[model samples]
Target chain A: MIPLIQAAIVAVFLGTWQMLSPALGLQFFFATPLAVFQSLWALMKSGLLFYHAGITSLEAVAGFLLGGTLGMGIGILLGRHQLLAKVLAPFLTAIYSLPKAALAPLFILWFGIGIDMKIFLAGSIVFFLVFLNTFHGVREVSHEQIAILRLMKANERHLLTKVIIPSAIVWVFAGLRLSVPYALIGAILGEIIAANRGLGFLISSAAGRFDTAGTFAALIAIMFLALVLNRAITFAEGRLMPWRAAEEGREVPI
Target chain B: MPGPTAPPSRKSSEALPLIEFRNVGKTFARGALEAVRDVNLSVAPGEFLTLVGPSGCGKSTLLNMTAGLFLPTTGEVRYAGAVVADINVRVGYMTQVDHLLPWRTLAGNIAVPLEIAGRPKREIAAEVERLMTLVGLTGFGASYPSQLSGGMRKRAALARLFAYDPETLLMDEPFAALDAQMRLVLQVELKRLCRLLGKTVLFVTHDVDEAVALGDRCIVFTSRPGRVRQAITVDLPGDRDLRVLRYDPAYLAQCGALWRLLTPPVEPAVAPQGRRE
Candidate 1:
């Protein structure tokens, strides 16, 4: 029902856009949704859309994996060890708050329009998001639970694997959910600034040629990919964390 | 009226006291304030001992030391003749809150200690099953801790403790969160299980009746910067049920004595320390 209502609202907005673009004598610079869809159809038929999408997807996936792994590892370490957390917290926080887009030019300068620059740019953005959330998650685990683990004579490794990791998993997943979009944004932004191939390049090139329909087509494709990735995250979260789902179910009675 | 039919054995003599706290003093310097004063207690083999006192009395702190979660500032806590430096795997500590890992299923939570101990797969499975049955959690093993009721979660916590086969059990208000009926049921089950396994049990509670009902020997302590007020040995009928013991006059007297020891003394009203009105 909610989706249906949303779709109706979107349709109305698109119809208004279609009517206003030509009525206001706006140049082809502002494409209607129909025109965007038509151009997307053309791109799809030419098979270039999938190729660019594949490149973008690879960068996004690689960035997400690298960022997620590094974030979780460092987060858990900082969370578990008080000395390291205390020592590195200020530095990490400073770096985390910096504008990620500003760093892209530097990355591009160093890596020179290659996949490494895009991957690193996206990875860095996603890394901090996951790291901070995971660190908080691990730190927030109850002292009482730690006491229990200790009393059970759990060694350091067992404590980390069984108690610490499982305890932080919900937070990790939360970080993952928030980081996925950042990953896509980073990749697209990196591509826009420097790349010759990717959805970002496609959009930039279309804009340069005043091909509003092609730009809009790229935008729609990005949105579709983002939605798909978000759903995948939700599905994975449901599978990995049935307990959280059960808790939510209990909160609101049917 | 009769003892067990099994013949007595020399092995009983070798059963050492599971836990012994001698002149144990734990003082938390809240800048300068002390939290627990001099205290001494011993938990005999197969005995149920309870530390009961008012809020802020450091009972939980005392239990933490016993579990080797914390070290006493000025005394020793020994388990099976060895001084406790770290947590003893031979001891099981149940906290006031169940603290069952929310992410794990009941069985998974119960299997935690076994998992930590690196038990074999077959052993972990069998032990979890046995503990579930023992705690009346047979069918609820697959359910997450959040899915269970408060009483059920407490039971699962107990099962988790038992699964580790710890010779000594340290409980810090393990049933304090449960409803009255649930508390009673668990208390009875705990007592029965302790006797059956001959495990040394040191349980802490603020409730007078619960302490009296469960403890073979009850140790009462004073309020903050706590000290032992009295140690009373309860010699109730060996086979008497907990339900029946509630009505027994001796039990009531013990409860009254414990209540008297726990109540704070009334002080005479006087002028303010630094101001005069």
Candidate 2:
């Protein structure tokens, strides 16, 4: 039923765009759905679609992995150490508040206009998201729960492995899920600013050529990629935390 | 027999108290709130001593001191002849809420202590299985805490507590959240388990009935800055059924006595400030 509603919403949006395009002479600025699909089909047939999408997907996935792991590690570290967390809190807040997209240009200059630059861009953005969530996740673990493990003669290692890490995984997953789009955005923005490949390059180059349909097609591809990635995270979360899944299942009656 | 029978030292009179609070006092929020004051108490080995008091009365504070979650602001809590200055691993502390890791299955949660203790895989598995059966959770070992009923979660928490077989159990209203029937059932179950295993218990609850039902001796604490107002030995047989005992006239009289001690006086008490919390 939700899928049907989503389909209807998409159809209505396309219908509106298609109807308003020629009427308003908006084809150059906002291409009709038919034109976008035709360009998408042309790109697919020529294999350019896969090339650009693959590059973007690689950048996003790589960035997500690199940033997610680093973020989670540091988050756990800070979460466990009160003094260190206190020392770094202000600096983290300052850096986190800055618009991550603004760092793309700096990353391009620092890492060059290669996939490295895009990966760094995406990874840096993802890092803070995962780190903040993981930190809070680790920090917010009920002291009672930790105390329970402590009373069992659990050492620091035991507490971390058995309770802290597993408890924080829930938050880590949440942060990862949230950062999926941001990761793509970071990669794509870097590619647009300076890159020969990726969906962002395709979108920017098409727009520069005034090929509105091509740009729209690239955007549609990004939307699909984000959707798939988000779904993958949700699936992983269910697999890792069966208890959380059970909780959600129980909530369905209400 | 019906009155509050003050026994100076009931069980294990010949042996030194397994746990002793030597003039223990605790103040919180930088001495703003006096939670417990000058508490001098002792519990014998294998004794099921229950502490009953009103809210904010610091009954739980004493348990915390014993568990070494924290120290008394003044004086010391001695466990096994040594002052508790660190996280007391020889005792298992169970709070009101079931602290079963929601990420782990019932079997997995129960296996936590054993795993932490580095018991062999087979041994941990067997112990988990045994605990599940002991707590009537045999078929639900695979279930998550969220998947289980409140009663079941409590049982899982209890199982987890017993996994390491801690010498002493510090329980703070561990069954207060359950329904009346479930609470009674768990009370009986806990009493039975503690007896069978010979675990010294320091159970804290506000319920006078629960204190009477479970304890070898019940300590009634005065409201906030909780001092021990009375100590009454519950002479009920160890193996008695709680269901039958609840109706026994002697049980009723004991509950009444504890209730009186727990309740603040009607007229006095600093003009009864803003309800009994």
Candidate 3:
């Protein structure tokens, strides 16, 4: 109730002051909420929103899946075998520290200004996020628990399925949830850098023509897509880890 | 009960010692610190052996060595006459803290070992339900570990250990975390289960009474680089009830003997604060 009331207060302020009232003679630059929504409606009616949004979503989701799986595999593999982690630690650190998105141009050079570029871009970003998280997850898995399973005469298959994977799922989901925004960022940014389609292109191209309303509309669409994806991951996480409810239920000090 | 020494002669007819630590010595910090040293012990088949030691005595370390979680630095640990080269699955381990997989319900926790063994689904379910009832968790099968009390969690852990019906049990203070009443209750239940299943057990704890009550033979350990101070063969009957055993003269005698060995008069004083030379 408090949040709803707070949101209403902000919405009323924005609607009245930013739209209803006259601006300080800056209409060309600052797109009002009303103008952004108007442009959004226009794009939706023209069916452009569906096409661009669809392309971005496809690139983001596919990249997310590909990167997430690759990251998890590498993470767990390295995590389970510390020797591999030691050998690759410096390399991973250096790569991870670099601005991965800066490589978008290089990827464009290799993969061209097509969906492939955007997909690879998004995959690279999401891969590191999930890899680091899964690695930490595997590390945090209790040695005592592993010892217990081993004493039960569990084979390697049992260790992975019964102990390793289940233990790492929580961290994997955390990485997945955080990757939603990064996935969109990667896809949209890649699109803006070179592509002729996607929300990123829509915003960048519109800005070139000084279409502030169109830019705002594209930005809002990106936010909406991110929210939807994040909600999806959250829903899946809840379904997968009902046990976490106990830990979450305990009151945390603010 | 046959005397602990009589086991050597009876080995011809009975099963051999299920586990043996051959002059085991474990050093940590690349040999900088010794946790347990010069420890040689054996547990016969279906026998209950309790290890009593002071805090940080590395009694648990010895158990880990036998489980093949850690290799002895200077000697070898053997299970069923074979050197433990990897994780030994012939034993079921119960830690001092009940590591009930929080995600799983009580029944699901019990089903873990069986499920890992690739038992039939129906069999796992039946066995889980049966073990839950056996551990006095009959109707609490669906409840998660967090929902249960500490003692109940311990029982659930015990059931999970028993799920696979392993021939040997390597327990590291499994009841130490419980309350006094719960500990006694669990001791009785555990004794009954172990006897019925004919499982060999290597139980570790710091409590002398608990050691005497549950063990056929009790090995007392000195602290820090733990070595055997004495090995007292307990005289209590195998099937003795926890209540009666608590007051048994022989039980007290054995417990007292171990206590004397562990905490002799003129006990070592607290270490110097390193202030004055």
Best by TM-score: 2
Candidate 2 residue A100 Cα shift, in angstroms, is 4.4
Q: Candidate 2, A46: how far from true, in Å?
A: 1.1
TM-score-sorted candidate list, best first: 2, 3, 1
Pairs of residues at least 3 apart in sequence or in different chains that clash in candidate 2: none
lDDT of 1 by residue, A56-86 (tens): 8889989999999999999999998999999
Q: What are the per-residue Cα lDDT tens digits for candidate 3 across A1-254?
A: 99999999989987775764345666688777788889999999999998999999999998999899999999999998999999999999999998978998899889999998899899999999999999999999988888888777777788788778889999999899889988998999998889899999999999999999899899989989998898889888889888788667755644
Minimal lDDT window, size 10, model 1 chain A: A245-254
Model 3 clashing residue pairs (backbone): none
**Candidate 2 residues B162-233, lDDT tens each?**
777787898888886677876776777777777776778999887778889888888877777888777888
lDDT of 2 by residue, A43-126 (tens): 999999999999999999999999999999999999999999999999999999999888877887788899988888889999
What's the C-alpha lDDT at position A106 in model 3? Answer: 96
Say which prediction, candidate 1 or candidate 2, comes out ahead on TM-score: 2
Report DockQ per prediction, comma-separated: 0.64, 0.69, 0.57
lDDT of 1: 0.82
* Model 3, native contacts kept: 0.67
Per candidate, native contacts kept equal 0.80, 0.96, 0.67
Model 1 error, position B261 (Å): 4.6
